[model samples]
Target: MRIEIVEGDITVRPVDAIVNAANSSLLGGGGVDGAIHRAAGPELLEACRELRATKLPDGLAVGAAVATPGFLLPAKWVIHTVGPNRHAGQTNPALLASCFTESLRIADGLGARSVAFPAVSAGVYGWDARKVAQLGIEAVRAYAGRPLEGEKPMVELVEFVLFSEETAGIFRQALEESGGGPG
Candidate 1:
């Protein structure tokens, strides 16, 4: 698998799927969730509504993920995962790591070759940027290292797409430290 860090908008990344750091409601809130919802258009919201009305009536659990079609965005699918809120007294690192792990698992199930992820829980959620980057890159690297039925990983490329240069740099450094930096 190829892991890279790019400083840009996650909405426009031409990947098969992009991970949204969504709230548990999946109804679209501030930060990356709102941006993805707006870019994916009303259909995305409808999809989330459908999920809530059916499979996820009680809303998505933190660290778990669900996928919706990317209606008006460059990507084909959007993988929504709720990150653990640090300020809410949810400071478990495993929860943060699960965000990346679960998203990749969902993307793999969707037969996605590439995925873009934001700095989940880094902003507003009150998680430290460096810790988020470290945990995220570590989780993705561990996931990529695991072999599937074909002895190869399903997700070929994982891009840490951050809107802020500082966050992007942090992820870049983390990727390098993990020995999974851009090829």
Candidate 2:
């Protein structure tokens, strides 16, 4: 497995799957969620609607992940995971860590060789950027160290597609501290 740090919009990444830092409703809101929803068009919303209508009627739970087609986006699939909101008293780092791990698990299940992830809770969710970076790198490296659910994980690349250079710098620092350089 390879780890990378890049500052860019998550929606335009051409990876096999992209992780969406969605709210529990999975219906779409702000930040990465809104951008992904907008870029993927109405079909994406319909898919999410179908998911809500059937499987996730009460909305997705925090740290859990689910998949929907990327629709008009470049990625083949979108893995939606809810991050722990620190302001809402969901301050446990374990829940934040789960977002990365579960998203990877879902990605692996979908046969995704390459995945792009945003800083799951660093923005509007009120988590510190450094904390989000550390947990993200730690979870992804741990995921890489383990065997896949089926065959060995097809995940050749895991890219932290950050929204800005400062955030990317934070992730890069974490990756390096974990003995991984930008790839």
Candidate 3:
């Protein structure tokens, strides 16, 4: 898979799938989650609440992602993954990795060619900037080798949207360093 890091707004990406920086509640809280819910309109809330009704655990990840009425957002589907909240230093970077991995698994199963992902858990989850980027890149690298279910195993393009220049530069440097050093 071709993984690229960019600094931009995740809501306006025209890719086939966009990952929401969702809360464990899945009810669309603040930050990126709020913006996505607002742009996607009210229907996303109803649909998301229905999914929440099933009593999904905080660690459970799911993903085809429901359509949010193409009038506002350009993407066809919004892949929702409940990312972990870091209250202290107890947050699991591995679970955060799972969020990306699982989202890609679902997207690949849906035959999605391109997907946009915000810096998962980095905003509110309190992961160290460089560590989060390393995990994100690692997850993408792992997913890149495995094709989605029932697909012919092709390279899925993954984009990590950084909210600031610092994060973007950190991710770029991490990728460059790791890419040349047997990551």
The best candidate by TM-score is: 2
1 or 3, greater by lDDT: 1
TM-score of 3: 0.84
- What lDDT score belongs to each candidate, Candidate 1 first? 0.91, 0.92, 0.72
| RMSD to truth, every model | 1.4, 1.2, 3.6
Candidate 3 weakest lDDT stretch, 10 residues: 62-71
Candidates in descending TM-score order: 2, 1, 3
Q: Over the stretch 1-183, how does candidate 1's per-residue lDDT look in tens digits?
A: 788899999999999999999999999998899999998999999999999999999999999999999999999999999999989999999999999999998999999999999999988999999999999988988887774554566899999999988888888788778775573
lDDT by residue for model 3 over 1-183, one digit each (tens)? 677888888888878888887765677788888988988888888777666665553423432233233235777778777666676554777787888788787676666788888877777777777887788788888777665554554435788887789988888887887684223
Looking at candidate 1, what is the lDDT of residue 51? 97
| Alpha-carbon lDDT of model 3 | 0.72
Give candidate 3 misplaced runs (Cα > 4 Å). 54-71, 148-151, 180-183
| lDDT-superior candidate, 1 or 2 | 2
Candidates 1 and 3: which is better by TM-score? 1
